[model samples]
Target: MVWTEILVPVLGGDNDAALLAIAKALAEPFNAAINVVYASPSPISLFSWAGEGGYGPTDVAVAAMQESADRGQARCRDLLASLDYPKTKFEAVTADDWIGLRTVSRLADVVIWERSVSRGHGFLANAFQQILLDERRPAIIADKPTKADGTIAIAWDGGREASRALRRAVPLLRGATKVVILSVPHAMAHPCDGSRAVDYLADQGIKADAVVLHTQGDAGQAILGGVRDLGADILVAGAFGHPRLQRFIFGGTTQLLLDSGSPAALFLSH
Candidate 1:
């Protein structure tokens, strides 16, 4: 139930600082290891010459790619050094190294992904999807680092996905100052009271309040409103509880929450 490994992926962009800050905050309480992965494509893949003919690139091209990758890795190391967090490891890998990246992600308790990265394009976005769907691990999407000991709100529906998310967030709930369970009957595909969730948290020594929201609007909007009203720093819920195909095309509550501009971080499990 303890979090020991927190996997964070960065592209050596301006977002690295914010992403690492939150990762460190989540790691401090548990003395967890922050494995910062820096993934970028090799120069060979960027040009067509390597793939056009059955010939490898010249030594000069290979060296140039290696130098670029080294610089990116060095910059990332500098950023981590400036943060002054001791329990951290920086890894450099090609963007196409799915096997290597998954090995790192599978061993992590949770993966921290920047909000913008999820909505972004190309390799990083593909990696995010693979880690969440293929790997089936809990993920936290954040625009900024949330308070480790702040209030938390849970979106409950008495379903397996929500329950799984709850279970994964136990360590965090135990550390929060306050926990609230928000249930919207009209907005749920299978609505149920929040008593069971409240009781479960109670058994875990977490005091929580169950609030039934009577909203006639979209389910995502209702949940977001509740989180804001409660001033919760983080929202815990199941991701893509519905059919993936359906959610992908027409979208669902999960998409809404993901696309929201809310500052609150999301702890999601599928």
Candidate 2:
């Protein structure tokens, strides 16, 4: 479970620097290849033409779209050139090119996605969600650079998703100066205690301390506070641990974490 290939999706925005900085920090230790991708939307859909007037010409619309995509690609290349990370590889592809993007994601050990990308509902958002949901890969949601050797916190709940996350985070945890398992006892009934998670990490030769949190609000808030208090650079947790229906309407812990502006980077697996 070592990370060898890291994927970072870019949109040619000013935030690309922040995203790449996070990727570089994660890649440096492992000597991993950073795949910097510029993902653009496909040509304008047929139904999305002039609303009040008749539909516009298809060729013109597609040409305009391609021109915009070209500009985005240029921006990504320029940024990569400026930073000059030795192990970075750059590519530009359309978000609708599912087969192509999925193939690239398949080989990636972990994807580094920007916080804004997760919040978006556009084409890039669809691509980001597919990489996690359809591909079933691990990801690091970051808004800024994360410390490569800082304390890492695992949000443990004794669920299948949490177990998967813990297992996937082993390689990264091995490098952390400190590891902590944060559990919310009052949030939900756990199948097993946080000690089980700590023991599992111990088996992997990674010593971790477990702390039970008694919270009055949501589990997500408690976990965030715990990470902040511990000064952890990264939070390892399962994405969408609750049922889809429940999270979709009322928003679950995963949603809350994703929407948060916390500085702590999230290492999530679904």
Candidate 3:
């Protein structure tokens, strides 16, 4: 699929505008149907608030939560409707008192989420992290509104996740005439082996050049420098692996790419 459906969360945060901009940009390429998801927090009962008697009664709290959810849904609808696209292309959905991550994963093709500190640190990060960690869908975490123009940098690690990301990014890659496949050296690394990734791209009719970067300092800084040198418009990379046991292990390269604030449309897949 070419990602004809896009999911944008309306969390009533400062980054709502950035999410909307991402939605707009995606719609241009995919003619995407936009889904505005609002995850209403579960209401806490008075019985649970034993220490704070000032906490409202159960019924009052329930009512307040419902009202807040209703307002959020309305606001999302209004914001999406105000866009340049047709209103029929956008829909508002509410997932109150439910598992937000599961709901988003089931319905969205590509999720556009925000990494905001002001949002208080619960569902926003958790939901996005879950989408990245569990779901097969590609996700774009908008730290700010991104302009999809620069050279597209593909972080190839020769893993399943990286392969999935490369497959999912075909549409974007096809449009980009200039693409670079980056591989970082490891203990098991070989020089000519990296050229196979370039060959794979050539088979798909995408003429890409592979450059092996030595694992010296920060992988993120090296990628940013490479992108700047190439004047890249976007960065294509796999989401990589997550923490499993107590060893703090991960597919390191993807984590480094995510932390890098290069102006690019991060195409991440698990």
lDDT of 3 by residue, 62-142 (tens): 787778767776776677777767522444344443355466567667777664421226556656666666666687765
Is candidate 1 or 3 superior in TM-score? 1
Which should have the higher lDDT, number 2 or number 3?
A: 2
lDDT of 1 by residue, 1-270 (tens): 789999988777778888899998999998999999988787766665656676777778878988877887888888988988888988877775576677778989999998866665645887887888788788998978888799999999989889999999999998999999999998766758799999999999999999999988887899999999999899999988888789778998887898898889999898
Which parts of model 2 have CA positions greater than 4 angstroms off?
44-54
Q: Model 2 scores what on Cα lDDT? A: 0.84
For all candidates in order, the CA lDDT equals: 0.86, 0.84, 0.65
Q: List the residue pairs that clash in candidate 2.
A: none
lDDT of 3 at 235: 74
Best TM-score goes to which candidate?
1
CA deviation > 4 Å runs, candidate 3 = 44-56, 87-101, 117-122, 144-149, 187-193, 246-251
* TM-score of candidate 1 versus the correct structure, residues matched by position: 0.92
lDDT per residue, candidate 2, 70-107, as tens digits? 88789888888877678889887766556667777888
Model 3 per-residue lDDT at 181? 88
In model 1, the Cα lDDT at residue 184 comes to 92
